[model samples]
Target: MDQDSQLLQAATDFAYYPGSHSDDSATEFLNRFPLPLIINALQTQFDVPGLESALVACLERLFKTKLGASLIPEYMPFVQVGLQADSQAVRSLACKTVSCLLENLDNSHKVAAHLIKEFNMYPLLLDCLINGNEEVAAGAIDAIKKLASCPEGIDIIFPSNKGGDTDLGIIASQCSSLGRVRVLALVVKLFSVSTSAASAICSLNLLKLLEAEIRSADDTLVTLSVFELLYELAEVEHGTEFLSKTSLFQLLSSIISNNFTDSILRSRAMMISGRLLSKESTYSFIDEQCAKSVISSIDGRLQSLDTSDRDEFETALESLGQIGLSIRGATLLLSGSSPAARHVIDAAFDQQGPERHGRQLAALHALGNISGETRSENDIILDAEAEENLLRLLYEAASKSSKLTPSGLFLSVLQQDSEIRIAEWEL
Candidate 1:
């Protein structure tokens, strides 16, 4: 038989149900076959639908063996070229073949890198992800998932912003594979990088879509992802500023204020609310938006600290301390008869672990800030007494662990308010 016929027969040997292959003939046939000739033939088949589809099938069969696996990555570009075929049938098969090559080349990252760099497989795979063909989309998902393991590959799979539609992420979401949980997970992974990744994803204004998901999606992964991204985004000035404009602060405020059955969600809401609203600068916004509800919700949560909800309890205390930094919030803290202050002080003194200590430090800091707030006409004496209680808490914390002394000593000067006494630090 001629060389082509021999290679064809060898591929056929191992192509059926890949279990317990009893022969080395597949490996032996691939090793003797000239790699350059096979690749040229595959490329040449691009315009011939029947030949290209058959050839891709043969390549898939070949890659099931050791020798073919070793050679496929090197010639992946020729296989990739078939993706441009006019026939959708040819295109779909090409995507599947590419996935096979990617699977076989997991260890050969350089080759995978080369395939993207040379053939621009990144955009090609995204098209597949968006393809109407489920088989092709599924194939591309595997390819994208594999590529994502390489960081640069993530950017390749996730589009960079080019000033397109604002809801690009959502638009793309509609085209994503069926049962889009994996797609949502991938989006979260991309957003984890930062705003750039967020923008690179759906559009320049990806946050709008993400916020929509956070507000509307009933899925846990989707809501949690939005929360996780929001938290991470808060770490950077750009992200935090973007979030502040959105109803994020309001959403978080509501999430904590409501009696959400999900304890973890409640805990996250409290932590995030405290994080975003704690700054004195944010006080005006909170006062205008959620002053009354913030006070009432945090107060109720603190009074009902269940052991199963200890995390939420600790987070609520932290939120309480933050609330004290603002005028509207400080009003709640300054009330001498309010159990909110007492709950905060009691929770603050707990030496259970480092996390609890951190929560305690937050409470002390809030009291310290409230002390410096110019008290209103009705509660000067009461505010002063609360200040004294705060100093006592600080001293107790410092005495227990000298490590806590720094947090005790940290101070901040609010823009609208005077200097912080317990010491102010903004994270």
Candidate 2:
């Protein structure tokens, strides 16, 4: 048999192995088979219908054996096809393959750029974001997130409308309940890319579409993602003004009253409250009731902390603190049972250590926000030692990291606070 046929046959036979093979035999067989042949077969399968099932089966074997890395370069085109394929099964497998490839940062950029250039794939992906099966939508969103990580990829994926009928309005309007949910999740992931594209996405009035979802949808993922996206957008220059015009506070109030049972949804609501509270326009909404609920949530989680619950609790507290900063409400919230919250904050600070200094700086910014309302009170004073530590963290973050979100916010807040004196020290 020719080399190609032999490789194909080997792939086909490999798919049926139910258990692990002995290391020596597996190593010998892998050594005999060239990587290019595997890539050719997978790429060919992309255009041929009904071949994805076999390809998936074979790829699973290859992935299991750690032989898939060699085909990383050739898999991008197939990954694109898998993303846009009419077959849900194929699309699902394609998503898994792309996710696996993303483990290598170099491959991620190459594949992401290629996927972004596949213009025909956009509408289908958008549709998948709105109407495809759940697995398909998840996969498509995952692909989009990876692609959006690259600036060139974002430019290609989110191109400007050339003045024709390119408004996302019709698509956004027609979204079914489930579609809206998935779209919200996708938008949140997209918004998390970088500040530049995030600004562009906000300009597209994507949040308006999300506001519609927040008002009409009940899905936890959708609601949470919407809140997260809004929070990110609010951190941008123009986002606060855009958010003020919407009935965001009213919608969040409704969600709070009716859906507190859903922890995920509640968590998102708290985050939105925090983001809105960061802005002056939404400060009135953070009344006694809202503060109490947020504090209670933090207290409850802290009382019964677990590894899984720590991340969510930290997020809730971070948002709560931001809200407190926006409205000068942290003293009351931080007074009683504040130690647990402080623990969470301090843990967030220490987790980043000196190497991940940006995260430490963000923790300091969060601390600043939390302490802003009570800087005068001895009960919640910003001690000199803590201030020095925060300054050190911010300096290290600025000098070392490229441009992290947390550290950026840290620098902005530190610069705004006249109490912070740079002339006294370096960084």
Candidate 3:
């Protein structure tokens, strides 16, 4: 066999070898075909059609074991070269290797610092983020997040000074809209790492970059992308405080209230708005006026949705549940002149077809959420009419819908509140 064929066979052996066994089979295997040998072959034999792919697969499997992961730092030079290789697959693999390397370390800060200050790989990672393909870009994002976990690393990723040589804002300015979106997503990830990381992100005013993208409204696809990122940010613990500092709450409410906005964008905006208010801890971040505006906008949306708009209808219902997660938000839903609460009840009892059944499921979930299915006793403050609606939902959902049942839905809610329990028994 030629050298390339020989290396391919060796890589296949490495990929298939079970490294998790007690016998240290990976170590035994490496004794015969060391990582250095494979790295040397990869450096010189990259031109060989299948060698790079096989070696990369072998490396990925090896990364699953402690012994295999411990050996990667010595091979950083090959990784650096792979990141700059002409082939997309190789660059993506390089990024994955960096992630694996960081994920496995006990003192990752040391390696992270070396990668940035000594190995000079940070720029190459950024290059992959900006110019790589989808897989490569995802891997780069993951690696950058892993690097950002440590205080020193996060400082490097988001420096104190704005518009510095390494500022992500500057990097994003050089990216296409899609690339900028990717960077925005990276910022969210970094923000979730620690409080210090979040402080770093806020201090540099990186969120304004995302806000600028959303307000530009020039590209529907790009705007949607930023909204999705905002949704992710909203999901992070304490992320709402970071978001509340910006005008994002008002911006999202505007997108939701605007009849001219794209339906899909409006739907996403409503869901994001709901998420911002869902957590009781974060509920106070949004002022009363803004929250009321959101409820009104979503009510208008639900009223506008017909049978043909099932997806939007379901989305709006789900968003309502998110909004009504808190007692205050649910109070707005139940007290408003808008028929939003009635609409939720009607949708829950609407058992027409498979499509309506789907909406029915979402509406049922929304109803349970709105009625304090998961709140503390002191927090579960449902009024008489609202209590009547919950009881009605239990009764009607059982008898009215042959295709579904609300027994499982109400069981938990029934357990939480004595009044509802008594009402349920009295019926």
Candidate 4:
């Protein structure tokens, strides 16, 4: 047989049983044919109905070897073309191949740069992610994850608004096509690109698209995935601040605090709250009703000692701490007969992981900020016991630790001297 026929047969055999092939045949195939020709043959073979999976398997196997890794660039054109192919199988095969190339190659930065600068493949990747088969869609998502990793690649995956690209907008409009898992993966992959990407995502109004899916989904993985995406988005300085302004924040807060929400999902929501509360300006934006719902969630989780959801519990404490950072929030939590202050106090003393320590510090900062609030003469937010509980917890924390480390913060010797004020919180 000629070299071309020999190469195709060998690949077919290897694809069906990677273990059946030896390095000898794979080496001979590469030695006889140029990378472009081999990639072309494989790309064309994807049209064969039953051979698609096997050919992809062969492509994956070839990419694992040194020769295959070096020739990744040769497959670039084929992949870009295949991404837009009318055949679902061809599109899926191309996506899987790109994922494999990115995974096996050491110089992915170069590969990614080639794909974006030379190939301009982001739209194709986005298209596959939106419309490809499940496994193929996942492969597209993986390619996106790689593209979002490097500076140049990140710029390509999440272009500035001037690019005249509307793929994200299309994804938002067609969100009903995305299930919860894909939705979570897409959001995470997009935000990881950059803070600027976060801004672009905000423009998409992505949360509105997924709102119903998040509310109605019953799977734990789905629930957890959605909330985690919310946390990731909220962590961004640009995205969640805008998101918080919309009723979306309140809706998520209510859903998360609901009794039926999974523990992990609830924790994810609490994380979003904590991130928003991280900023004093954003802290003020959380309205009273939203804060009340947040408080109720914290109280419910704190009371659930029967279920040792420590991570969720810690998250609740952190959210409550953020709420406490605001005067309005602190007053609500530390108000007369409110269990909020007591729960915050107990969380501060729990002595769990370093994570717990961070949560405690957040709670303490909220308390300190609350204690410093000078009520109007007619203000009645804090009664006698509330003041006493607030003072007592502060003094206890002050007496116990020589220094405070509240999630990257360090109180100075001067600030340490302020510990005496903990005892002075008498109303």
Best-fitting candidate, measured by TM-score?
A: 3
Regions of model 1 farther than 4 Å from truth: 1-123, 127-167, 171-205, 274-296, 304-308, 318-342, 350-389, 392-427
Q: Rate the local accuracy (lDDT) of all candidates.
A: 0.56, 0.56, 0.76, 0.61
Model 2 residue 182 CA deviation (Å) reads 1.1
Residues 106-212 of candidate 1 have per-residue lDDT tens digits of 54655665576578776666565564366665666666656655556655554455433322355445653233433454454555545555445534445566567
Error of 3 at 354 (Å): 7.7
Give the TM-score of each candidate: 0.45, 0.50, 0.83, 0.55
Among these predictions, the greatest lDDT belongs to: 3
In model 3, how large is the Cα lDDT of residue 287? 72
CA lDDT, candidate 1, residue 300: 79
| Superposition TM-score, candidate 4 onto the true structure | 0.55
What value does the lDDT take at residue 141 in candidate 4? 83
Tens-digit per-residue lDDT, 3-85, candidate 3 = 66876987787776655432286677677677888777767785788788888887777765778767777777878888898
The whole-model C-alpha lDDT of candidate 3 against the native structure comes to 0.76
Question: Cα miss at 83, model 4 (Å)?
Answer: 2.0
Residue 337 of model 1, lDDT score: 52
The lowest-lDDT stretch of 10 consecutive residues in candidate 2 is: 418-427
After TM-score superposition, what is the CA distance of residue 175 in candidate 1 from its true location, in Å?
5.7
Question: How high a TM-score does candidate 1 get?
Answer: 0.45
